[model samples]
Target: MDPLLSLFDPQVDSDSEDIIITETRSATLLSQNGSLPPECEEGNIEYKLKLINPSKTRFEHLVTQMKWRLREGHGEAIYEIGVEDKGLLIGLSQEEVNASLETLYLMADKLGATITILRERIITNDEDNCKARKYTDHRPHKCRKAVEVLVRKVPDDQQTIELRIAVLGNVETGKSTLLGVLTQGETDNGRGSARLNLFRHRHEIQTGRTSSISKEILGFDNKGVPITYNVCRTPEEICEMSSKLLTFIDLGGHQKYLKTTVFGLIAMHGHYAVLVISSIGGVFAGTAREHLGLALALEVPVIVVVNKIDITDNRSLTQTLIQLETLLKSPVCKKIPVRVETEDDVFTYASRLTTDHIIPIFTVSCVSGYGLNLLYKFLYVLPPSVSVNDRQRLIDSKVEFQIDETFQVPEVGLVVSGLLISGLIREGDYLKIGPFDCGLFSPVQVSSLQRHKVASRSVRAAESATLALMSYNNDIDLEKSVRKGMVLIEINDNSYGHKICQYFQARIHVLFHVSMLCPGFQTTIYIGNVRQTAVVVAIMGKKYVSTNESASVMFRFIKQPEYIKNGSRLLFREGPSKGIGHIVQVFPIITKTNDNSL
Candidate 1:
């Protein structure tokens, strides 16, 4: 095993003498007696013999290198003191070690970070010889020690870290129950009592199944403690108290509501997906495999959860795990399944979840409250996939908000809920929202903004919120003009040429088509939050296409023109056929015709 991989291993004793060291060495660290390693390498881990008494230039260079390593590890890095470039344990004296640690603190201070000593182990003369022993005869002949320190930077922004997770699996897999237990801070009564609060409609409560997309939140403070109804009274309080928030998009698990589930997975921009499997039923009943395939196709990282473990025996649980492992390792889903059994497993798996192939499997029972703490810890440590650079770009770009759902409240006249895809939006800002019947945008004012039911003055990019809109045109009816899939864009000083399109060309790859796809085939296409029926008017270079085939197709919406952008991901489905593609070209609607005959 790689020595760095074992850094978080729970079984390894930090103070033991039998410490495992890798053959890899850092070329940047200066060695006393030996030369630098043959290959220079820089990564999350760095080695240093000691940092006591360095020149001014050398100190600046060291600080810069530390900053690079911290960024490489996503705001975290590990340093090994009293080690040479060739993995040699050249132990330092007690005085030298203290000075080295003090220098590390200085470096961290300069970099706006905090340092924590993870471990320390002493080395005697028998195990490894110190090169400085030959020169220092007046020092005491005591064992010298090496220290491992972790440096983490404080997040720059004050806004809470938000991560959207889509919860999906087959029906009756305890999806709602697990989320209820997680967010409500209450265990199940074994009769589906915990999930009652999450249901939206009477039909869902009566049938004990979710048919619509619902949302729940799990908040964690800076110290990683969960803040739920036990401590907070409302979602606003939870948001205000949390430093990190996990928005759970609870989607339906049945095949009948597959469209709604697909929309939730695609439109919500989920960073990760949690696939719940019932221990008694094992797998492959209704939509387990389908949900898994959809997640993979959409390029969403997945974590597996085996629910209702309190009812299953050991043998059955083992069997279920075996079956899941086989499916995950299959060709269709090439994922490395790591069963999380301890806190160490949670830390290791959460750190590597962005790798796309590592799938962590967790088993828990909401009724018995087994293995739920580990799950919560994993979520608390899970990092958002959106990079700092990407977020900055979004903030610098023009404002674009995709409308997902709209409402006409009694007090709040016209309210629209959706995601802010780019730029920032503040209360009382004037913007244009449209693509009405005439395919034109209309000016509107943002009366107010609410996020997670908490009223806020402003909402930034990649955050979900509801904006109460006031139409500037008193003659127009807001309810008749505004609809789902419309966008609210900020009107700049040079805004021009923004119109909706009825026809567009896209490059599509059919995932699976029962029959050949030809021209005039009608299907429901979902792009962002837009769901409309479109017919294939032309196939660029082919007469017909089949499963796993690629082609360029021209589609015309059956209804009015919709506002769509180029390079947007689109999913079209009809019956058992489904395809995923992106919009490559858009043709604007031409409403005016000149009379040439006159």
Candidate 2:
């Protein structure tokens, strides 16, 4: 097999190895005499054009300066790839280099520029270093450390390709269980025993769900390229690592856990998002509807995983598949059924199913370690280049939470437990929390944080984060500062928030048959996982609202919710059921169409 082909195959290598390129170039520019100078002369392109490390900030900075020189009539600067980090750094003419220095100074003030060797030399050594560094070995290359130089040509095309996959679904749908099977290998021993022990013995909580994200790594060879898969626990974690990786994010799918907002569905950012539907349940739940709405908004590619096939009846499985297909008819879902019976069966099924064009199914029990290979193969076979931007704003993004629990520790000072929809807080980071939205808020410090039972240094934008913090102001009112379902963050964006007596807008495709809709009826409004009893003060676009024909509506929340800020989001949880309709707006009834009385 060709060397390049082997690099792209996962079966070949386990780690990324640098691919080398060799090239020779002619000295096109003439000396003062209009002829090629002797090899000893520094003016000769043959001697001056050499490859330097690209990854080094110094190398990239030099290249950028060289481009500016070439643009300013410094003549062509040629180069070749030497070491992977040292691609090629071409030297520019003296006058051009001087001009490039001015542009560099301007960019440094706003976004902090890396301390480049060239910049360091220019700043410290000034004229002498510039003259000497430009010509010979007398002046060292502007670098943090001495660098080896290699004569080489830069490749015309340098492309960095990566894949991002997200897994999202309702709560208790075995989201984390399937993640264990897919990512488990000889190296993984499951979530750290130390963490599990803490929850079981210390917390006294019967059920432990994912609090913060977890991280794992999978390395294999694809063709000849060394393929490294960075596996993360949540969608936000995936984005943080997306800068340079083929990342796969495993999200927790639980209806009650889903924060339901643009911020809540953040884990959905990927080339494609895979929805895990349990065959154990046999039907789409409310959480499924929320996920579908976000998917529709983003117009992303959806792949459905029908997990736990070993326990589900074939008849129920078939029906579930049909229903999912019908609901997601736009791109149509690629279905993969998972059955776990034995460890050996894991890889056997993984390899077979992903090779086919259709969605492949493998039976594996995460507990017993089955069908793991099939999961890996399916992930490795995914196509490249997918974007999710258009439907990103389908629901409101800003939100606050109803504190299900809160307490204070002498070591930490204060610990707040609640759902988050809008603003993000990280460990050791400082935040302002209080009423009046102004000076009332005292800066609070977060230290030693725990999410879902997993202790994390920090937490992202999520409905879950059982936070432990220390506030500077002890006199501050903890109760009044954070109201249940109150606005935790007043988002800067005017377009977000719960609009009362306002039309609640949403995108409802023909796939979703109307189950129930109460116009001008009293129902509880839940925003950012905070449940509050509020009447549906009014409904707009009557013709479209009732027919389920209109895509958006304005819902006037009966009372001005405490924490709900402008552009914040809310969902309708009818009667005793835990979850229900999506809310796009909540505001005062100013229009004549207002029907429901306060």
Candidate 3:
């Protein structure tokens, strides 16, 4: 047995908060020498000491069992060969291991899946154990080995899997450049040449800083090979050829554009966040820390990228890494920092990124392309935070599409691009879009749909698309009726109409407030894609609140009544004062009528 296996505690509670408990348990099980039946499995993992030979019926049963395990893990499963079900690592001979792998491949073939070997270790016993061996050979024999394999089923419905990653950091941290390098497959010239294509406006190019939210894509095929502009020449081509798509939300890092960054993070529904830090400059600047805090508060899984490695010296790089590790390990973050130096580290971390505690740090230089391949591999294997069942539940629920950007094309009429937070939206579906100054949703037809610049018939929950809207019933001007922060919801004839209101109550945590938060204290509030000024009307159960305090507060929008949902995340900020909370209750609007009798 491996010495590491001796430290394993089989009786430890599986529900512990430690994210790596699963991996540890797997390791411990693989090092044991006992065997148990497959029916005794308790988790997504399964063990097989060896499968060199099996009856036809047994093989079929094993395939069926693997199918069930795959379903439990949502199309992903792990298999430990040369390990017994009783958590024993009974190593297999080289021939036995080869035959077992071939059998596993056959099983995967039956389920239309692919397998990747994660690790292989040789188990060697000491001479004292060899002396007690009952083998025919008198010489001390080397023990057998074990292998850990990951089996991933190719999604049959959608050709490609989508993962949105919000890229955030402080100014000059190379967020845009890193994205450009990843998506365009071109190294930077060290003078902002790579980021030129990602810039939206002339001002951004002139200043060499992103001031608004931009997006770029990097695609990976089923085999985990990147399909960038170098191979496809266009995004549409990449989408057509790739089996997985990674959407990078390139957000501004400047303090002035912090609101835009926050909106991108919230509205985009990013599965993970990639925070870039400069090795030379370090994270001493408060903006980097602020960005990290925002991601943490939102509960977004983060992967830190220490950039500018080609330009920085060893001392500077080491110092920057130390600072980042300290922050991640601090009480506020409490993240387990794993420095990714090899492809193995990437695979291990990517498979476990959903735990929200493992923070994988990567060191890369856009100019020299150091560690870029490892980053791409990591992204290729990173599973989405949301599962298929969750998405299905949203699809079954009422449709709620939050508008993030509105545009009036020359001939296309009005097009609103946003995410479908719930339910399904088809091209011909008629929905109510609103909360204009009049505080009501008007009927509109979905004339067309486009995702990733490719025309599509429909969009599903958690998917982003631009929907062209046409006036229905009322002769509504879409440009005037639709606005950012508004929602397009499916109409239900049976229920009381959707509520719109200006006043709402929220339980807020004052993350940081320079002064006491009293009644009438106003700040810019952001809920989803909606950004509006709101004033605190009342503070419940408290005279006043300040930093690190919590209170239930009544807030009224300064403008019109906005369509807000219950339990929606709300972020309010004024200068350095920032607070994050969620809507707890909403008050309905009451209209007064003219009374002739009075």
Candidate 4:
């Protein structure tokens, strides 16, 4: 992590939009203001003085370099033309820039990639204002410009680059409204008119509160244009036209819906968490902070959004920002906060998210659409935190799909929706579903699957989808047998990861609790898509553990056995008490009525 700043940058205390790139490293926003930062030794970002023309050998080498950069970025990279290797912004003339762009186009085309001109800035130079004015010529020219372009090439195996971001904040923080505006290509009416498009239930529409997990996507095509234009009016159209997809897992923000929120966090396979804060109230005294903590504990990268700026007064807005800055600097989060206001801020800060502990703070209003373009551009270029290698490894590993939500559509029959944690699933592939209440696995086949509301023949790891299932034996009721938190795994004669466990041991740290936590303390446990109540049957080598204390504890699922894998991270909570840990050991199956102690 970059060294933490002792305090929030004083320049940010004002109500003016922040233009910070927290890291003083390459491509720092401040450096770009007067001079380009020194070229970075590594990363997908590259600097070029000008590529107007090159020899065949040099062109081939440049193409190879571009290929490496695309791989490093997992499909996308930034090329800063008219910038020198020594951090000088000695821009190029228009003709040179045109030729350079033509060369870039050829380079991208040669590598089967596409290019999008991100932005171009004309650099001004006044000899009269120079320190060496006496030695300067009579005329000053400002025709040169610095251009930034995005080059993208999706890997051969993937159709679209998908990134899931869980939207979390207190109720009325504009989570739903924000998504509605971004996906619907319309601003709110100050009365949250845009939000109406996202509500799934009557109560949500009437009360303006979300009680369930709703999803909406914002997509970008290979040319980096948002697919929300009038022509692409439907999800299917957006999916069909997009090369990159951003799935916003809109979660409930009320305290009562915390479980739903937590489930969404774990089950959605989120690559990042967008913590939306209301500018009027800052981080709500309760749910918002809790959501941020949950995201950090889960190790998910977070981006902050302070919404409703259109309604907030300057004084209050400043105060809220200061508070957030202070809280993020605290030991609990230890995050470097970057304030984003422009397109430059977006690229500089967003490109470095996965490499550092920096968190970019975006202030926007759904009503006025303030600062929204920056946010949209940021999401467009935001890289997935999961590396291509790791995702590929999971896709090749044993098949494991988690069940979080299930539906029974009229013509589709029984449909199960959740994330495919690993491996692949194809239509008609035989798979084992569940460690039913009886603690055993059953055989089932995938009738069909859908991705992004479009029927698809197959699904891959790290992708969320709805799978229609068919059980040939009919020994178990499809509607009654399948439940949330169950597994759908590849059929194996040995039957691994298909059995349930009644008790397991874990190393846990208590986050908060009034009194010492003793054996028999029970709480709701959430691991992946699994949610169940468990009791601490025993504390290893210790009788009691209090707040901030760590201990190895044995837990028994109070209701029924659950399919828990070893080394899986988990979160447990009850009332004001909470803890996070991982399953260190999963014991063999024990019947629900078993009373034998370990």
Candidate 5:
């Protein structure tokens, strides 16, 4: 028997001087020279975790639980390593690793064993590889981006922190009214909201409507929860800003901006989203569909604020709440909280009304200043923390500069103008161009970076930067590689693109119908720079879209093209018409049956 396996045996005497080797089905425990054997160590380190049970858990969950236990000073616990798949692999920091060890001690106690960890000395002769490895662990995952924007760590007791709130919703959904009412004393009637503190102060702040789409710091809590907010208009803007940990994202209420709204909800990855449904507008109409879609897509906690209650007929607030409850109970937003609040003082009174677990609803007249206090209080109570991490979810902080116009500078060969989706990109950063084709070498060093066409020192993620990248002497296919809708990302070590048809499947929401026979027909696709014609081998949907229905369709591309990673904007064009439908699934193919693939 392996020396490590013998230590874990139940029959092994606890007082044995020689290393007691014991084996359980999955894990082998040993106490020899204060370190376990290499294979056993590898087994524990490479253990696949499940989410359902404590024993069977994912890496991130296990690490998190371990950290918590260690912080509480409990050592020695045993966890059954579960299987890992689909973005469940979590890379922990040094601090997190230490915390896990502490928790592992707790596991040891639970399982009646004393365990110790031995550091693996990784000696490397290559300088670049070592640097890349060091940075890679600190940086986002190889494939996805790390969460760049973090909530400024605050003391547990402090309730208020400076927060930047972006007012978002469909057009004419009282978005402007809400902003105007909140900034009545400060903002002019025609002007929109830029920055106004809902918290009372002596003098009003003259905040100009932000001229750019990039996130701007609005204010901070006296204790410093930096409130930086930006209003999103385009899909690029939504994608960029939502990648950060913005305190409050107020979506635009304009119906035309549905795409922006959807992207914001998904990208922001908010733990809690405030869905403002106008009471006068009823529950299920134009903007309601849009809001409902967001509520469905993201299973985050939602607070539905029913605006314009004052304008409604004799129907009491209670009746409207009941109406909202009925709709929210649907799969989209279940157990939504509704509240009817009249106008009151901004600070003292507003914070009192924002409680209620499932869905906190507030009925306020943005025009009449009614229920404004309640909104403030609710905003105050929001959890100021971000989710696991953007990189863990395969989200990258990118800047998609719409090639609005380009020009050549004397010093720099070619200068491209566009908005950064996310991440602060400066000069000399090695950019991965169109997959790993050239191996992340052709560096697009920033000769000059600008915002609103004006030059600036550094450009932040989700902001617009008119950057002048040092062009390669040899003219690469810049047209196809760097064109409209092309994204720029700083490549991480694990950032390898995959061209797989069976990429952990999921149901898709396909729009724009061309032919009924198109269901099972395979066709060519051009996603980013990838051009592959795959067979529309299988369609995974029973319900057909009478008008617009979401279904999962499977395709087997002719030649699997690299750079066509999951969620790489799939543009399916039938025959000559280039793009017929958009591709949303890139993470995993959720459901599948045998014999479906060719």
Candidate 6:
């Protein structure tokens, strides 16, 4: 076993670890110098050409900075000891390296963080000339050796850091099979026996095609090793024992279920997207390309998975990879393809994924379990990309929960499940659910909350959970009143009066269209979890908007009013026509009522 492999890599090491990179324009702060980009003030990645013995005050300041980096990364930080602040890979001497590592470990101990030397790199000066390739670090002559390390400490306020990744690809691309192998501790039998447990519908089981959204969770312990059924008897036990949770939203890949796929991408609020491309079936099948386009339009970062390598011939696999790489490099995607082939590559790319526009592509087989270890290591180290300030704002904002599914449990009353858009919620909290037929909200009490089938003390911002609800005053018929696409929010006032929107304005860019889009054009509109049919009422400064054009358009929902918010991402589509926008303003239809509407 290699010393560089961390506990989560391939084989387990007793040692514990990216300074997490955020997905924002923060990287623009860097200035390119030669080939290395200078370090920025923000983000979890810190570059130190060398960390040697420093004064007492200097060491304290270094510790403080590491603390902030950990917070920004939601408890993870990356320290490149041999890298310069300006991104130069200058290796230090063996004596200097040891001293530098001592300083780093001390700094981590001050903040209760765990540290691990992730991997090492050898840098050679141009002066080394022809012998650079033959030089080794032990010689300590004409060569520089650098080391990369990972620092980790779980946040104090939360037990686990949660991340949502949406799985998308064409039908029969082995999406479910890959997820099943990852979540369950089992390999396939070359007959797709692994994916059978993930099917949600009778037709899907009969046809082996997913037609609805299904969810599977992968848990990792604090040291970053995966926790599966082998370690825990049940998922509830896994949730309790793990420190990081990844929720994979599995969506339908067939064209007939495109709407369902869109709803999951928008409503689930996924932080990352896994675009699966089958090596044998090739890239152009079912809705593979369309799924990629949707993920791009929604601004979700993507990781491409090339599955079914065990069954594909080398020539076919090469051709499929070339085609997939070409599609990724297209103007619309404009993403660089980074192939993950080793443990070192996995650690390097995963730590920088959120900050870079490069997409990590993996080749894996469910039956043989080839390349799965590398993928797991990459995912285990990946952190949530949302910045700290943005997360705080969402937590401080008013509570709003979007309903994606409704169910009737025998023991429990009405059970509504979805993502919590903002604010915090606890059991027994009173919230408002509605904008019903006549446009009014009714009071409802949260009886209990369950996250991943485990009883939750509370659910906070950006977390998904199912809440058991009981009608306040028992006046509303829970089953008849609650449905999908509605919201549950907290009302601070006694005023029963509420308003829903029938009209809204958005700045949109037309991606594709059969013809010019003009007034009275009807399309399916998706914003968060709310899906409705809306007709374009007017286009400002233009009579009609065509493909590749941008405009401000006003739309009115045809069927009913919806509770909406300003600045939400909006997508509209009809047949093959697709356009994306954000709500700039909303026109509310105020519904004044002393009670709930049915």
**lDDT pick, better of 1 and 6:** 6
Model 1, span 1-598: residue lDDT tens: 3221111222332233232222312222232323333323654567888899888999999999898876665456668888776766666788999999999999999987778665566655642354646533425457677776767663575357788999999999999999999999989999899899899999999999999988999898756789887788899899888877899999999878988998888888898999999999976657777788778778889999999999999999999998787666644465678789976576556766785367899999999999999999889778667765677789888998989889998887999999999989999999888777667677889999999988899988888999999887775788777898888887652232333689999999887766799999999999988888999999998999887778999999999788788899998988777888999988877544221000
| Models ranked on lDDT | 4, 6, 1, 3, 5, 2
lDDT string, candidate 6, 361-462, tens digits: 999999999999899888888977765667778989888899999999998979999999888999999888887766777788899999987888799888
Better of 2 and 6 by TM-score: 6
TM-score of every prediction relative to native: 0.82, 0.43, 0.88, 0.88, 0.46, 0.88
Residue range 29-69, candidate 4, lDDT tens digits: 23435466688767788898889679999999999999888
> RMSD, each candidate, Å?
8.8, 17.4, 7.6, 5.6, 21.4, 9.0
For lDDT, candidate 4 versus 6, the one ahead is 4
Candidate 6 backbone overlaps, count:
3
In model 1, the Cα lDDT at residue 425 comes to 94
Compared with the true structure, the alpha-carbon lDDT of candidate 5 equals 0.40
The TM-score of candidate 1 is 0.82
Off by over 4 Å in 2: 1-176, 180-274, 278-301, 310-363, 377-410, 416-430, 435-443, 446-467, 472-475, 479-520, 526-531, 540-544, 551-570, 575-598
Candidate 1: the clashing residue pairs are none
Which candidate tops lDDT?
4
Candidate 1 clash total? 0
TM-score between candidate 5 and the true structure: 0.46
Candidate 5 segments whose C-alpha is farther than 4 A from its true place = 1-170, 180-217, 223-257, 267-272, 309-319, 330-332, 338-357, 385-427, 435-442, 447-468, 473-485, 490-537, 540-552, 555-598
* Per-residue alpha-carbon lDDT of candidate 2 for residues 413-495, written as tens digits (9 for 90 to 100): 55776545444555676554432222123455666666434566644333245676565665665634554332233323232
Assess each prediction's global lDDT (C-alpha) against the native.
0.79, 0.39, 0.78, 0.81, 0.40, 0.80
